[model samples]
Target: MRATVIHAPGDIRVEDAPEPKIVNPTDAIIRTVATCVCGSDLWPYRGLEPVGDPHPMGHEYVGIVEEVGSEVSNVKPGQFVVGSFATSDNTCANCRKGWQSSCLNREFMSTCQAEYVRIPNAHGTLVATDEHPSDELVPSLLAVSDVMGTGWYAALAAEVKPGSTAVVVGDGAVGLCGVIAAKELGAERIIAMSRHESRQKLALEFGATDIVSERGEDGIARIKDLTGGIGADSVLECVGTSQSMSQALHSARPGGNVGFVGVPHEVAVDGQELFFSQVGLRGGPAPVRRYLPDLIDRVLSGHINPGKVFDLTLPLEQVAEGYKAMDERRAIKTLLTP
Candidate 1:
């Protein structure tokens, strides 16, 4: 087996690795069929995040279960599954409250960028549907593993409602999914703030009612114009930057809510500014596992294809090329196959 390893900044390689084996009663092992490079992965690659030691690099995947432990019941050895970025024991207090990311005994999720991975707490962390689609739907299924989940979280946190005007910040995969999420929640007007033509097209396809091509005050002006001088009813922040965060804040009307799901690189908010506004702020590391079941059903039923965000594909050995394309802003997202 081979896994993607990041030895240092601007460095990535495929190294021979041993096949993962189930070591606990609740554990399961899966062979990776499809995986993807996320915007978060670029932080380490671009030296924006620390790289203290060589580490495995991926957190999204969809594959077939090669083996399962004795205690695993819901999922079997031969089933196809989609897993969250966090591994949790579904029986725990937090898991039952729709917050599996904070499960009492949750295990830190490892990158699934390899050919094989050992999934702990398999019964609680993995979900199996009827029939797994062929290679064509693999990318879409894998999207539910992370970005799509995070986007859905953003919509929920923002308190979106039908006939409500919504604004989305950032044009990444997660932001685009936020568009789909807002639509699913019945937002009457979806305003996608995107400068890139490519992502703007996808945003519209996902149900954005309008597109704003400006930044700073100008972007906010466009959003206000669309809403007839009032701001949006809700705003979803998908970029973890001060500028993007500020734009989201300025685009929401009084008493509106903001759902920020970006990784929060170095965000700072002005207390005085927020104090005078009626907008509410809330968001954090997404509880992706919370929505996996509903999302998987939608995918399996063909209600959505969030996986269309992947604009580039590469073989496992050429995984480095996939990273380069994304880091250089040449591709929206990259999908890798084993």
Candidate 2:
């Protein structure tokens, strides 16, 4: 099978690779139908994160079950399924507490930008649709696998409440989905911080009531000005940069919360500042498995179209261009079909 491999920073290639097999009884092998380039993937691509030896890339995927291990029962061959970037055994203590992303038996997916993928903890991680969805719903279903799920977790972590003011600090795919999540969760006023015209338009279409194009202290001031000098009730930190994190932390009102979902890169928080600000912070990998069933339903029901975040689509073999487009900010996200 063909898969994406990163030989080094600024170097992405599609090469032939061995197909994955079930290494554990709880594993299942699926033929990937749709996958995509995630914002996190750019970390190593841009040299922000080290790329040691060459390895397969990608994680977000929606696929058709090709085979199942003996222990796998929830999904079987011929079924369409969506799984999280972080696979979990869902039966673990953390999973029982709704934190599947931190399950005792967890595996992070890293080779999904291929024709096939081996799913760990299949019974607990893969959510099967009732029937095969139409072609049009595939992109949205694929989005539910990661970006949308992450965005939803961001909103939940920030404690977005009905009629409350919410701020999203990012314009990427996940941040755009965060806007959708905030709206669905009843945030009456959604402020999306973006400088890109396309992303700002999408954010508005996704239910952003205001747009703040400023950065640094100016952005925080704009948030405060819009919130009547109190800041927002909740802030979603979708970009993992030091500046974005600080913006999110300062954009929230005292006693409010900031849900940070971006994979932190050189980000540090001042404990003294946090203490004085009295803002809550909660974040990490999203428990996408916990929200998969509902998100899948929402996609099928046409309630949300997070798939719109994918402004570019390419064949699986053109994966390198997908990475390039996203890295250059020419595309918000790239959809890859195998």
Candidate 3:
């Protein structure tokens, strides 16, 4: 099988690698049908995160089940499935509380940008569709596996409510999906903070009522001005940078909330500032398994089309170019077909 390997920062290559096998009784191997480059993958690609020895890349995937271990009974061979980046047993205490991402037996997927992937905790992590979906729904189904799910979690964490004002502090794929989530959750006013024309347009199409193209203190001020000087009722901090985090914190009114989903990079909160601001904060890896069933249904029903975030598509063999396009901001997200 061919897989994406990062030999070093700014270096991505597609090379032959051994196919994965069931290392545990709960494991299942799936022949990847669709996968994509995630914003998080850029961390190591841009040298923001260290890339030690070369290793396979990617985590978001939708595939056809090729085989399952003896203990796996939730799915069978030949079924189409979508799974989260964080695999969980789903039977654990955390999972029972709706936090599958923090399950006792959890494994983070890191080799999905290939022809085949071994899914851990198959019984609890993989959600199979009733039947094989049409080719047109594949991209949206693949989006439900990660980006859309993460965006939903961001909205939930921020406590987006009916007729409330919500702010999204990023223009990436996840943030765009956050706008969709906020709209579906009944946010009457959705403010998307973006500087890119393409992203701003997409955000509007996804239900953004306003766009704030400023940054730093200016962005927060714009959010306040739009919210009648009280700031928004909820803020989704989709970017993990310190500046973005601060913007999210300041963009929310007192007693409001901020849901931060970005993998925090050099981000920290000032204790005094947070205490005085009285804003609630919650974030981490999304429990995508908990929302997979509904998100998949939404895709199949044509209720939400988060797949539109993928502005570029490439064959799995051209994975390097996918990474380059996303890194250069030429594409919001890249869809990779195997």
Candidate 4:
């Protein structure tokens, strides 16, 4: 099998690697049908996030089960499934509380950008569809595995409500999906901060009622101006940078909330600023498994199409190009087919 390996920052290659197999009775092996690059992955690619050693890359995936361990009874061979980037035993305490991303037995699903990959805790980590999904539904279903789920978590954490103004910071795939989630959650006003025309257009299509192209304090002022100086009721911070995080915090009203889902880099928050702002803050890795079922249903029913985030699609062998396209911001997200 061939998989993506990042030897170092700016060093990525798709090369031959050992195939995966059932190592645990709770595991299952799946042949990947589709996978994609994530913004978080860029942390290592850019040297901001260290790679201790050359290892497998990619976490988001959707594929057909080829085999399952003896303990995995809920899913079977030949079933199409979507899974979270983090594998978890659904029976854990955290999982029971709908925080599967922090499950007691959690593990990162790495090196999935290959022909086949092993899924741990298959029964709890993987969600099987009612039936095999068609090719047209694959991309959207694929988004449920990570980006869309994270976006949904942002909306939920921010407590978006009917008739409330929800501001989304960042226009990446997850941010755009946040717009979709906010709309579906009944937010009357959706403001997306994006300078890119392509992303702004998609944000509107996903239910954004306004677009703010400013940055930093100016962006915060724009959000305040739009909300009559009260700021928005909810703000979704999709970019983990210090600038974006501050903007998100300032964009919300004193009693409002900000949900940050971006993979934090060199970011530090000021205690005094947060204390004075009086805005609630909450966000971490999304408990994708908790939201997978509903998101899957939405995709299966064709009620939403979050998969439109993938502006570039390429063969798995061309995973290098996929990364390049995203790294250069030439594509919002890149989908890979194996």
Candidate 5:
């Protein structure tokens, strides 16, 4: 099997790798049908996140189950399934509470950008569709694995409500998906902060009612101006930078809420600013498993096209180009077919 290995920042290669097999009764091995590069992957690729050793790269995946372990009964071979970025045992207390990302037996699903990958907690992490999905539905279903799910979490954490003015910071795939999420949540007005023409257009299509191309304080003022100086009722911070974080905090109305979903890098918030701002903050890795069922239904029903975020697609062998396209801002997200 061939898989992507990150040797160092800006150094990635596709090379022969060992095949994966079920090592535990709770595990399953799946042949990759589709996978993609994530925004978070760039953290290690850009050298911002430490990478002391070469390792497998990628997490988001959708594939057909080739085999399951002795204990995996809910999902069997030949079923098409979507998986969360993290694994979890469904029986855990946190899993019961809808935080499968923080399950007691949780494990990160790395080494999936390959021809074959092993899945732990198979029954808990994999969501099989009602039937095999068509080729057209693969991309959308794949989105459920991470970006779409994370965007939905951002909206949920921000407390978006009917008739609420919601502001989204960032124009990446997740931010655009946030626009879709805010719309689905019944937000009356969706403001997307984006300067890129392509992303701004997608934001509008995803239900954004306004676009703010400013940054920092200027962006905050624009959000306030759009909301009649009271700021938005809810703000979704999709970029984990310090500037974007501050923008999200300041874009919310006093007593409003801000949900940040970006993989934070060098982010430090001022205690005084948060204290006086009176804005609630909540976010972490998205519990994608909790929302997978509903999101899968939406995609299967053709009610949403969140997969449009993938402006580029490549063969699994060209995974390096997929990463470059996303890092260079040439593509919003890149999808890979094995």
Candidate 6:
């Protein structure tokens, strides 16, 4: 089998790798169909995270199950399934409480950007759709594995509710989807901060009511203006930078909620500021498995299409170019087919 591997910073290659097999009673082996480059993956590419020797490259996909372990009763052979980026045993205490990403007994679904992948706790981690979807539905269904779920979590964490103002800081794919989630949750006003026309358009299509082509204080001011001098009721911080986080906190009204989904790196909150502002902060690595079922159902029913995030597509062998495109900011997200 061939897999995408990052040998070092800026060095991505397609290399030969051994085929995967079911190693646990709850495991399943699946042949990869579609996968993509993720924003988080860029950390290692940019020398932020230590790029281990010849590490596998992705954590999202939709594929055909090749085999299932003896204990895997829910997923079966030949079923088309979508899985969470992080796998978990559904029976665990954390999982039962809807925190599968932090399950006490957890195993991550091996990198998906390869010809084959080993998914542990298959029965609990993978969701099988009614039928094999059309080629077009594949991309959207693929999103249920990660970004879409994370975006939904962003809105949920922010406490977005009916008739509330929801401001999203960041114009990335997850931030755009957070706009959709906020609207679906009944937010009356959805403000997306973006200057890029392409991303701004997608945000609008996803249910953004207004666009703020400002950053820093200008962006926060726009949000405040939209909210009639008061800050928004809910703010979703989708970028994992201190600038974005501060903007998120300032964009929300006092006593409002701030949900951050970006992978924080050396970020800290000022105790006095938070105390004086009276805004609530909540967020962490998204427990995507918790929303996998409902999200998959919505995609299967054609109610939402999150695949719009992937603006470019490439073959598995050309994955090196995919990473370059994303790292260079030339693509919003790149979808790769194996």
Name the top lDDT candidate. Answer: 3
Off by over 4 Å in 3: none
lDDT of 3 at 12: 95
Candidate 6 local lDDT, 7-88, one digit each (tens): 9999999999998888889889998889998888888999999987778889998899999999998988888999888888
lDDT of 3 by residue, 108-194 (tens): 999999999999999999999999999889989999999999999999999999999999999999999999999999999999999
Candidate 4: give the clashing pairs. none
lDDT of 4 at 140: 97
Give the poorly placed runs of model 1, Cα more than 4 Å off: none
Misplaced by over 4 Å in model 2 are none
Instruction: Answer with 3 or 4, whichever has the higher lDDT.
Output: 3
Where does model 5 exceed 4 Å of error? none
TM-score (C-alpha, index-matched) for candidate 2? 0.99
Query: Residue-wise lDDT of candidate 5 within 1-338, one digit each (tens)?
Result: 99999999999899999899889999999999999999989999998999889999999899999999999998989999999998988789999999999999999988888989999999899999989999998999998899999999999999999999999999999999999999999999999999999999999999999999999888888888899998999999999998889889999999999999997788998899899999999989999999999999999999988999999999999999999999999999999988
Global Cα lDDT for candidate 4: 0.93
For each predicted model, how many residue pairs clash, with residues at least 3 apart or on different chains?
A: 1, 0, 0, 0, 0, 0
**Residue 314 in model 6: shift from native, Å?**
0.7
- Candidate 6, position 259, lDDT: 93
* Clashing residue pairs, backbone N/CA/C < 3 A, model 6: none
In the range 1-338, model 1's lDDT, one tens digit per residue, is: 89999999889999998888888999989988888899989999999999889988888888899989999987887788999888888889988998888888887666688998888888898988678677777887899988899889999889899989999999999999999999999999999999899999999999998999899999988888898797988999999999999999999998999999997888999899987777899887677777888998888788988999999999888889999999988999999998
Question: Stretches of candidate 6 above 4 Å error?
Answer: none
lDDT of 1: 0.89
TM-score for all predictions?
A: 0.97, 0.99, 0.99, 0.98, 0.99, 0.97
Q: lDDT for model 6, on a 0 to 1 scale?
A: 0.89
lDDT of each: 0.89, 0.96, 0.96, 0.93, 0.93, 0.89
After superposition on all C-alphas, the RMSD of every candidate to the true structure, in Å, is 1.3, 0.6, 0.5, 0.8, 0.8, 1.1
Tell me the lDDT of model 4 at 19.
90
